[model samples]
Target: MKKQNQKAWFFVLPVLLLVAFNALIPMMTVVNYSVQETFGNNLFFWEGLGWFEKLLRSERFHAALGRQFMFTGMILAIEVPLGVIIALSMPRSGFWVPVCLVLMALPMLIPWNVVGAMWNIFTLPDIGLLGYLMNHVLGIDYNMTQDPFAAWATIIVMDVWHWTSLVVLLSYAGLVSIPEAYYQAARIDGASNWSVFRHIQLPKMKQVLTIAILLRFMDSFNIYTEPFVLTGGGPGNATTLLSIDLVKIALGQFDLGPAAAMSLIYFVITLFVSWLFYTLMTKDDE
Candidate 1:
């Protein structure tokens, strides 16, 4: 018993130490900053929960938070069902499977900054293929920089194009893992394609769907790069997301106290919603 316990500690200790060094320390520092105010020249004062109270009352924070939630909600609604449909349509076996998988994975391999930059260039009104086609070929006034709705649409479309592949890949993995016997049984019972998918594939893919939704939600909620690069949160704060606003406060205006407080609130909101998602998703599993 003593030997087993010692071996278990040996395996777990490294990971625990790594977590402490990497995550815990940085988190503690943020927590400390969130509750304090600092002036230049190394002066610090304990403000307690003053920052938090101010954040809760700030209309700017409220607007940004609402917009962030709207973006996240739209992303999940669009990506989840679309990914499921695409996954279900993909061939289970054949020469095309690897080809499809590789193609799907390609977008995910690109660096995030590159993805943002690419979209930024690709949406240029005069030079970009999409911009040219939309403006000239379709005979429509479509410039994301000028139109708020256009900017929002472009951002949503860009995100879907970039990240939908993640959901596709995860759902595909779940679909493949489903035993062949289940399909065979469904076929013997004369189940239609819809019935097979509804009764069999959907149920089997639940866990992966949960994981994919959670990942996409958190990522989209905290999204800062693509939209930032594409829009600069510009056209007069038309796309000023919480992250963009947070950065504006932290670095642009150099308000560390308020920024730290906002960041702490951001972290708390993410944690709470993530917990809510996990509970709802896995409640049925239990």
Candidate 2:
């Protein structure tokens, strides 16, 4: 019998300890807060499931959750197909590949808060370039602050601009990994472009696309900063996603029990939906 190496356990132990400290401890603290009401410093009262029950029945929670779903659904619908199309259009080789990749990655390189602030300034009705163009040159009423429709459009557009690049990069990676022999074989068989894509490209890219969909879904569902900075959840709660609403409850209203319950609920929903997506997408493989 050969002796197994035990030294690797030492390397993994520190990471496990770090995760327990950072994630597990905080999670336990949230769980504690969820079941108990805090009146002030060192004062707590058991609330049991009251907060969870209340939140489940709350209209505000429902509305925010609905908006979150809508946002995530729209993001996945737009980004996945657009990313694939952009990837397909990209050059397989030569001078433009690096340039195009860099450009696609540029939006993603910016910090999330900066992206929000940048768009906020870029869409100001008076001084902003796009705003001026729409209002003056194009003669359009495009104030996101006052109009719900405009607000939705602006946030959606902003998200697409910022995140579609992730999908594009993933799709491009999938595309480039395809062996040239597949194309050669397709040509030998006189396969049409559509046929080639359907039979070869789409199948090969399915895994990456699945990854892209899940990532976009989670990010869009939990998104807070950009939309908050851009619309402040108004004109009147038009874009108050669940995360934003959770923060409003936790910080703004200072409701610890309810906020903790909502946080747990939000986390569970995300985890369950992501699992569902992954299972459905990969079921055919199994």
Q: Could you estimate the TM-score for every candidate? A: 0.93, 0.95
Distance from true location, Cα of 271 in model 2, Å: 0.2
Model 2 residue 115 distance off true place after TM-score fit, in angstroms = 0.9
Error of 1 at 111 (Å): 1.1
Candidate 2 segments whose C-alpha is farther than 4 A from its true place: 1-12
Q: Against the correct fold, how does model 1 do in TM-score? A: 0.93
Candidate 1 segments whose C-alpha is farther than 4 A from its true place:
1-16
Task: Give per-residue CA lDDT, model 2, range 32-142, as digits (tens).
Answer: 999999987779999999999999999999999999999999988999999999999999999999999999999999988898889888888888888888998899988
Q: Give me the overall lDDT of model 1.
A: 0.90
Model 2: pairs clashing at backbone N, Cα or C within 3 Å: none
TM-score winner: 2
- The lDDT, on a scale of 0 to 1, for candidate 2 is 0.93
